[model samples]
Target: MYVGQGGLIMTEVVGMVFIIIGIPFFLSGTIGLLRLPDIYTRLHALTKADNVGLGFVILGLAIQATSWLEVAKLFLIWFLVLVASATSCHLVADAALRRNIKPWTKE
Candidate 1:
């Protein structure tokens, strides 16, 4: 059997691990959205989860890729995800701040 033949099993395991790790982050973000007292805090959770989830997913993909071309594609995907997520998060936060959405207090 070829390395690529066993690669499928390895890829499946890695993908599953990434998904499992990402689930907690995603769920935490959802919970924060529901439980957080304000928009800023909710945005924090959202951005954190988005970054973490993308990181894990990209790591899994990188592990699975065998060729230089495949790895380059994964790198591009990771870069795109990072840029998009950060830009979106910044935009949302900026919009909220501009609109004067108050942050939560510990009191």
Candidate 2:
């Protein structure tokens, strides 16, 4: 949607750029999960997506957001995901350790 009658706004263009930049972070994270050798490593990649990738996405969305309330909600959701991803990653790693899952190593 055009924010102005003349043309697209700078913020919208910047926000779209941010969104485009964010996609790779997400794809890499997904690729990491499928291709990584171990649980910890996979968790690392996924959390990168949840943290950095999602941040870019949320930021872009927030920038393009029409209302302040929407921005607030975006940030709130980002914060919650951050907390949850971190906690879950830690717990999964801890459980893996308890189960004696060895990190993959190359000789």
Candidate 3:
């Protein structure tokens, strides 16, 4: 039960829904990171799924924000996370390539 904070029940519920939706994406990404055979595949899974997950979570948080500024800040945080993850993933893949790490094969 929402107490105080103007009791915005609808927004709160919607925000929780978004958060719940995002959890699975995060979980799947983590599972992929652990189960994938190669660095490239793991990186692919981590960045793609986790980014989407974070986006959904951020959207949910933004929906529940009390003010425009809070929403903007949330968006900014998501953007920064997106940039950081992408840059780190690229760097890691490049390093792996430089080290001659081969991709996993079925055989």
Candidate 4:
């Protein structure tokens, strides 16, 4: 049935799907952080989770937003998150390298 002028029911369904997909990425990242054997590997998990999880969350929010202003705000927030997370991760990795943290070597 039609829920609203802008198809609220469909939008809500898509938003739910996006949120559900994002949850798995977040969970996988957490697991990686706990289980990975090295700092580099852990960084991989963090980056993947940060990008995918934020992307999905933002997409879901955008789908549900009824106004262009709200959607633009959501996009701006996502962009900021992406930049911040990537830059922070890079700095952390560089610091670890400078401190001589040993990387995993294939034996």
- Number of the top-ranking candidate, with lDDT as the measure: 3
Assess each prediction's global lDDT (C-alpha) against the native: 0.78, 0.89, 0.94, 0.88
Report the candidate with higher lDDT, 2 versus 4: 2
Residues 59-100, model 3: lDDT tens digits: 999998999999999999999999999999999999999999
The C-alpha TM-scores of every prediction are: 0.72, 0.90, 0.90, 0.88
Residue-level lDDT of model 2, residues 21-76, one tens digit each, is 89999899999989998888999899977489889999999988989999999999
The local distance difference test score of model 2 is 0.89
lDDT for each residue of candidate 4 in 34-89, tens digit (9 for 90 to 100) = 99999988999998786888899889989988899999999999888888888988
> How many pairs of residues collide in model 2?
0
The root-mean-square deviation over C-alpha atoms between each candidate and the true structure, in angstroms, is: 3.2, 1.8, 2.1, 2.0
Task: Point out the worst 10-residue segment of candidate 1 by lDDT.
Answer: 1-10
- Which is the better candidate, 1 or 4, if ranked by TM-score? 4
State the lDDT of candidate 1 residue by residue for 46-93, as single tens digits.
878867876776777677677889878977987887788789888988
> How far out, in Å, is residue 11 in model 2?
1.5
